[model samples]
Target: MQKVEKVTDKLPELGARFTLIIFLITIIMNWADKNLFSPKLNAILEDFGFAANETTPLGIIAALFMITTGIGMVIFGVIADRGQRKWITIICSFVYSILTILTYFTPNGIAGYWYLFFMRLVGGFGLGAVVPAIFSMIGDYASPDKRASTFSKFTVATIIGQMGGLALSSGFSEWRVGYLTVGLFEFVMAVLMIFIKEPKKGVSEEELHSVLVAGAEYQFKFKKEDIKILWNNKSNKWIILNFIDTIPGSMVAFVLFKYLDDYYNIKESDVLILMGVGILGGIFGAILFGYIGDQLFKKNKNARAIIAFFCNLAPVFSYMLLFLPLFNDLYVPDGVTFGELISYPEVQFLTIIVFISLFINQGNGPNWYSSVLDVNLPEHRSTMISVASFADLLGNALGPLIGSLVYQFISGRAAMITVAIFWFANSLFWIPVIRNIKADIENNKKILELRSNQLKPPDN
Candidate 1:
């Protein structure tokens, strides 16, 4: 029996250019997310004059958009695993973009709500297909040493997208501007994807079968087994880091924005500037973490997890700081027309609240997230990522519901604090995840390599 020579996962000579394209895709998708219904939310609410948190109808409408990303990704992940990325990427891009643009014409109040919902559902299906496919391509394209850094670029694009959405959605009091912005961007990106090519990998049915048997190929064989594998692998089991950290972040986030907007009495126009502060922080953090992650890769090759651990831990302090009235957050009330701190102490309070909020929230960036995706096996990359995405979307779906419940039972500071407590409890989940970061990365590589070879052609 002849031993197969191993292939190095180094960047192709044109790797920099390829990475740039991936970055653009990340930004576009994020823009689609940020702009979708958020900017129009307040306007829609005003138009409907519905009580706050009574947004069940729109929530359901918007949430339908996320469903496909969660449920659909699992199926498409399997498809990408089978090495059908070429067509999947192109088509999904088209679907996601067209649906996003359709958002512009959505009728306002109730009618507008349904339009956004329907388009989101279509976009979700398209989005469902692309993520895993991209990861699979990146897995093959990037060398292990530089992979984390490469993936960080994607995360940066995501941040840019969120920021873009922040700007687009918040740009107009009318919501049409946001819809147009997201729609045009998605359509343009879809058209641009025409020239980008990721050569088919393990492109044949036999090779596909070999990869699945070896755990490299996609499978239709959904079982308790798929999730079981997520927990069964000793190294993989620790991934609760992904699940644990993002929950707190997502749960109170929308409310926190409201809290800040209310705190500083910030107008719609300032929200972008307010959020932009965090985006700037993310840009700095990405550069810092990318540098650190690359260095750690040289020393330990599992730097992605280490960066995640540190990034996850940073929010703990930030969350607590917001709970403060004097020591941390100190923003003023929205409509107080008195002296700065004399006639209105609330404004002073709000000012402090936002400053800290900006400081603490900046931690949500590529520094914390891209590492997890970068380290997973390429074939299983989408599904593994979907695990994190699933946890997030699941939590994203659940968190706001809890916030609604809290608002019903409590009011003002108490309602805010109740959500904060729930957020803090999840911080405990990251500890186990971070402790074994190095082990998970190393084990994943070993497992995938041994299994991946089986997916390779006998000649290669």
Candidate 2:
């Protein structure tokens, strides 16, 4: 009988603790940048040419920012794959936080256009760089069964940071306060990053050679050839489409709130409340969906993709429920405005809306991210993630501009409905893609199980 080794049989729990702690620190920085712009986005729009139905350049700033982030992910994924993960996370933590806070320095108006755009773009790049590094760090050291739960813990911490930002932003009169808060959170994490240890990559028997290049000679260093191999792999095409799936959701989350503020005559203050509820919902949602995905996926490796593919239906319906204007006719009973809100009704409704939307959004994350990882070859997984991240960014950059332009041409009412239709369209895109995804995941699992016979025995 072959003596088989379990990859995680004797792993130290300390590694997991340090990884989670570092992950939380990273979330602090992420929360800071994400929230810094939150309170001020409307004010900046007002300073420019605010209107009841207007979409600000902030949408563009965010879209463009995500593009840079995608670019950073691609660049840093290659670097982290070849070099050190710890320092890469540290550098990105510093860059994203500092740049995000710098947005507050921009003078309001058209003058701030370039200023805000650059700050947002740079900050996005920093976030892009670090997220994959965090994933890589955890993946390198985590036991297979623990990966999703470990990942979820980091994601939940991120939700906590986001919740903190939303809560604080809801209180403040000035946008700078939110921006300063995110900056401080990130700056502190930057210091904590100095202590993390980079984990060594595992080399299994089937992966003794390259995942893409067959028998072609190569070292596992960053090179143009490695990227070329990544691009030529046709099996990855669906993964690229999965990235596009993220854009519509991100658009609705980041820009739709601003649209809601204007259309419903609700205060921006209440929008933060709505987002706070979203943050809370996302925290729970990450744990729930991630746990489900991990557990179901154990029995059937294709389970995650299948779940994600089906779960896409949830957002499509949620957006429709949210966008339908029949409810718009419902009147706000007197006493609710941005200020002097009677907590009785105002707080309750906003919380419901936010929690529902958060559920929709968070449900999409784990299935989508984990599905891609399940299918990819370990040697090429980092590259695949980078490409997918890039594709998602490109789609994200455009989703907002298209949504904003639709509103620009029509009213926010029309734009909301159109966004609903767009969400449905995006969900449909998954149908054809998942057929291929299921096959790949099944094949990968078969191969992994076959190789288990050759694994080294666990040291007892």
| lDDT, candidates in the order shown | 0.55, 0.62
Q: Which regions of candidate 2 deviate over 4 angstroms?
A: 1-15, 35-39, 47-56, 161-165, 203-235, 323-326, 333-357, 438-460
Cα lDDT tens digits, model 1, 360-446, are: 433334434445544454555566665666556666565555554554456435546765565566545556655666666666556
lDDT of 2 by residue, 1-460 (tens): 2221223322333554665676777765564455444445566677665663466466677678778888998888878777777788888888877876675676766776777677786777788888776765555544443456656676676667656665666667766667766776777777776765554443322332122112222234556666664554444676576665655655554555567555555556666666665677877877787788778866776565566665566756654555445556544444476444425353455467657656655655666666556565454566667778788878767776676777678766676666556566566656655566566755665665554434443343
lDDT of 2 at 291: 81
Q: Cα-based RMSD of the predictions, in order?
A: 6.0, 5.3
Estimate the overall C-alpha local distance difference test score of candidate 1: 0.55
Reference-based lDDT, residue 354, model 2: 59
Each prediction's total of clashing residue pairs, residues at least 3 apart in sequence or on different chains, is: 21, 2
